[model samples]
Target chain A: MLKLQGIRAGYGRIEVLHGIECTVGDGEIVTVVGANGAGKSTLLKTVSGILGIWSGTIELGSTAIHKKSVERIASLGVVQIPEGRQLFGPLTVEENLELGGYAKRRSGRKAHAKLEEVYELFPRLRERRRQQAGTLSGGEQQMLAIGRALMAEPRVLLLDEPSMGLAPLIVKEIFTILGELNQRGLGMLLVEQDARLALSLAHRGLVLERGTVVLEDTGQALLNNPDVQAIYFGQHGGRRDSRTESA
Target chain B: MTFEQLLQYVASGLTNGSIYALTALGFTLIYNATDIINFAQGEFVMLGGLSAVSLHEAGAPLPVAFAGAVLTVTVVGILFELLAIRPLLRSGVLTQIIVTVGASLAFRTGALMIWGRDARPLPSFSGETPVRLLGATFNRQTIWVFGLTLVIVVALQLFYRRTLTGKAVRACSINPMAARLMGVSYSRVVLLSFAVSAAISAAGGVMITPASFMSYASGSLIGLKGFAAAILGGLGNPLGAVIGGLLLGIIEALSVGLLPGGSSGYKDGVAFLILVLVLFARPQGLMGGRIVDKA
Candidate 1:
């Protein structure tokens, strides 16, 4: 339940996302796929209030959240698992997760409510909970980033490249986990450079080109589209995962 | 000097080190939270010492005097944050730095006018008795100072480890943007850092007064030493500051023991020289992490 209309965002003197329009429907998994520097991550940053927008509106549910502080936005139940796994390096795995649910911990009892479920979801994290987050492997850290966001019990999870730098097997495992979470009704906006995996796990996919949404389609439809095939899937739609086609 | 002499030196060093460590710990805490080297920290300590001495003379009991000193300086720290630091919240670190440094000088000069240009001694709350260990003798005052500093550091460690607010502060230090996203008021956290930093510094001043001479102008050297200790320990690590402070004091003491002029005139130079070499050798300091220079 998030919407961005004609949103423009950028770093100083360099605009990245130019007038981009996108939406995440309630309980739907929406994926944004583009090359590096296509503003995929920038769009997520703008939505999560890490970067301010230059123009346009970003709405979480019906409320305009762009003007709110990052903490306020998070309290409003929009949590982001930023690119690079950026877990608090010196803190333990559990501490990182504890901080993820900081808004809830302060203002209410919501954090305690999710503690059991979070531990259940990432049992390995619970096992090595006391270990420094920096010491965790890339896959573990990615899982931690996701788990940390989940601890927030966010209304909308904005994942910026959860699959980045992971081994192929680990990437597959993580995507499988995301799809499972989506089935359990977690709304997500997954940003990725990998078209095949994102499209496979998502209900709908949008292609970003030069910071603009260039293509939007149902997952299966995009998987078979000729132009999408040419640019991302290969002319023969070769890289489309067999599991997604079967599903 | 005999083994007793060396023990006495170490005892004094430990007491002195505790003061430095406690002061540096505050600096490190604030730096970790806000990434701004608060030059005004020494004034908080100075303010504490001065307040205690002033109130004690005004017929206040020792505990009451100490409490007044702490409250007075805590208010000053909060005021400094609200009035001085609040405006520079969105400004560059350089602006914050210059603004704070200016505040420290203003504060020190203000104290000079208020207290006059004289070194003042605080009455020992505990009766001044020489406590003996082995063949060495040192004042119970030194022991109390070191004890209090140890208590503060341990309490701080517990705060960071066992408390939610402390964990939130640690999280903020690690990632402010992330902490903000988690609904921690960015401003509130920064101010909290300031309050805690100032409170710790004030406590240091309180404990230190019974052990050493204090004057308005002395703020600079104390602040510099505290800062050097923080840098030596790694800017954010409290444990680092303690170790760094002890290391610094021992080195300075040894310089007195070994150097040509030694304590005659070279003691200050010893601290400065160690500071320089530490900056050159391992600039990150002991408790420092993978932090880049904000400057």
Candidate 2:
């Protein structure tokens, strides 16, 4: 479980996250949907300790992590699959996955076990285990990014735009994987520009507008809300119109 | 020149090239980790040589002297990171690079104060008996240089490819932010890079001092050559650095042997010429595909 309270953070003097509060309960997938520059990535970066918060506290299961180093935060199991699928471009897919479990430095058997599990989840990765990450296609790269993060054996995964730049079919596959992982009880805080899919999969959803939470509701309720539909689902409830009507 | 004469030049070239390879390897480690061209890299080499000489003069056994010099210089590298690098980490890459230049000056002046201006010799690891190979004769130190450089390179390759820490370092070099998210400590990796880099350069310094007597000012030229070698091979690629070093050394030796009278005087200029040529023609070096991050 992860919690943030009145968190203020930014680049230099310009604040991006203005006293925002949020949480991801046990085995919960909390999706934050917002427009560009709405501080979604900043919130994740703050939680992962890549950026120091100006004020307020971030706690992972009651332990304060606001001032910890990025590595310390990660070792505490707050691993982030960064925006843009920032996999080690030159390293082999297996090497990238191996590095994911670096914090714990798992034993040979344990690491091998984790590797096997990840490969099972992404069989394409096993086939291309020796290939450099940069050479992978966009969908495969996204899979490798998720597979790499899972290698860390994280308790709470922070995903930033996992669907960005991914094709619709690939995004569907990714969301399916996320839903499957949540069913297995892996907590997640997902930031997405794909509001419909994120809400459909999320148990709870928050609409982030310019660094502030403008709305919070059950995913289905938010999906059916008039304002949410107007802004995110488009006036006529863009393609996949059937789902919007059903909601 | 006779074939034996050519063989002799290559043999000599290889001996010096081993030193350049070791020094360039140092540059690669630090450059890969921090993206800062540490000007003080040469200082570590000079420190290694001077410290070993002092220890030898003070009656420590040769092996003990060499090991002590490496340990001393490694500690200095760690201190430099903690005291100088850690403070300026947030100050941007250019500022940090400038600080290294300043550190080099400080190290040079300190060496001057401690050891003065005289060049000091480290007795060869083994007696200077000439070994013959195909009618070309070279000293035992040449064999030692080759053997040690080979050992260091093999050990380094194993480290990068086989060990978790080494992979973590490689990961850091590739993507520091991503590495951090994976729980790899960036600062610790940087520190390890500095320490290992200093130890390697120090070892090279200790080994080569017997052949080329070292003074307080010796680090500058050797460091420059090493940098040139790193650039020639591809700055981030370790194997490239070693090959570049050997090539540069051989070219310089060949130039001295074949060029007209007084050409030997320009032996040092050869590295710079190669350096400029590599930058203009193939900025990525021979092995690298593209410049990943620039300082």
Candidate 3:
């Protein structure tokens, strides 16, 4: 399990996360939902070691990871798919995936095998293997981002706003892929703006407000919670919208 | 100018251009990795030539002296990175550039203190025989310069395209945060770039020192020429740097040959003239695009 205790982190002189505590267990999906500036992304950055915690302990299984560098944290199996799908723009899709596989320091044969698996998961990437990553569509870029992270063979994946800017149909496809990966024993800690969809797919969900966790419950119970429905699911519980959008 | 004279000038221009291209490439390598124009790049060349001269004077064979010089300069380049750049990694780009300028000054002064003010000579790898080609007579060292530049360019292309480590360096240049997330140590890339860049420039120095004598103060002028070439080609593009160097060298040589009355004195001015015109006319250079691509 990846566990955090009293995590406090922020940009210099401005605290974004205040005493946040969370846990992502083996083979589980934990989704965090919040409005903008609620420290959702900050939480993930701290865990991935992209942002240092002011005071807290980040432990992956029995290993203390707070002092580890970003590369070290990633090599220890906590990989992050950063916001905006930060692909190397001028590089080909295959090159981007190949670089991701470099994190593990495995043999060329193993990296090739991993490349094949990534291509299997995202068939479009295989078709566009030689194409520059910057030319891909928003949804395709998101898939490539996830595919890149998977190349690392992470024990726990931290995703930030994977559904942002993507069409509903594409989001559904991506979430389905995420569910399949979770089913195959990959642990995910997801941050999403779409609360209903994230809660539905997640095993457990948390409601964050301004850097603090306001609520934590099982996915089913969070979906049923009146407060969660009122704020996150809208006044009508989004019944008039698509099923994925509504609670 | 007579055709043969023009040809001779072209030959000499090409030799100088090769050296400038190598120095510009060193500039490009560091610029791509850290966005700093390493002002000390030409100092590596100077160090290489002088080191080889001293080692050869100490009774080492020409090839061994050349190798030792390159190795020594490579170590200096790495030390420069570890001592000068690593501490300022978190600082602003402008500050880092200023540090490189300071480093260039320090390197020049240090060279003066060590090697004194006299211009020194290094024996050519092969005996100094004049080779004639297409009505142009040139020293044998010119061929070595051309051959080494071609080899380095090809080797660099293969490294960037075919090797995983080279791709990792490219990845870091594109997006350092993403590279870090992917387990690439950013500092290592910086160190590697400095080492490779220094070694390349040192090779250029070793090749060209026999053609023209080297002094402690020679680095500043060559450094300016290299910087001019880099700007002319487009600052971040490696191939462009090579082309720019050759073009600048030829233009400068042609000016010396064609202009009337003591125009040789104005040869250095020609490089800056092109630099000014290029900066005003097309700052992105001939091969440079809207997007900056680094090797």
Per-candidate RMSD, Å:
4.0, 3.1, 3.2
Candidates sorted on lDDT, descending: 2, 3, 1
Candidate 2 lands at a TM-score of 0.96
Candidate achieving the largest lDDT: 2
Question: If you assessed candidate 2 against the hidden native complex, which CAPRI class would it receive?
Answer: high
lDDT of 2 by residue, B1-295 (tens): 8999898888778888888888899989988899888888888999999999999999999999999999999999999999998899989888998999999999999999999999999899999889998888988898898899999999999999988899999999988999999999999999999999999999989998998899999998889999999999998899999998888889889989987893689898888999999999999898883385553
Q: Candidate 1 or 2, higher TM-score? A: 2
lDDT of 2 by residue, A116-208 (tens): 999999999999999999999999999999998898888999999898787888988998999999999999999987788889999899988
Docking class of 1: medium
lDDT of 2 at A99: 93
**Ten-residue segment with the worst summed lDDT in candidate 3 chain A?**
A236-245
Give one digit per residue, the lDDT tens place, for model 1 in B209-278.
Answer: 8888678876777778888877777777879988888777766666666666546377776667767887
Order of candidates by TM-score, top first? 2, 3, 1
lDDT, model 1, position A142: 90
Candidate 3 lDDT tens digits, A96-175: 99888877876668888999999999999999999999999988999999999999999999999888778889989999
**Can you give the lDDT of residue B106 in candidate 2?**
95
Q: Which ten residues in a row have the lowest lDDT in candidate 2 chain B?
A: B286-295
A5-124, model 1: which lDDT tens digit per residue?
989889998988889988899889999877656788889989889899999998988899998878889989988888897788889987888888777764346555576578887788
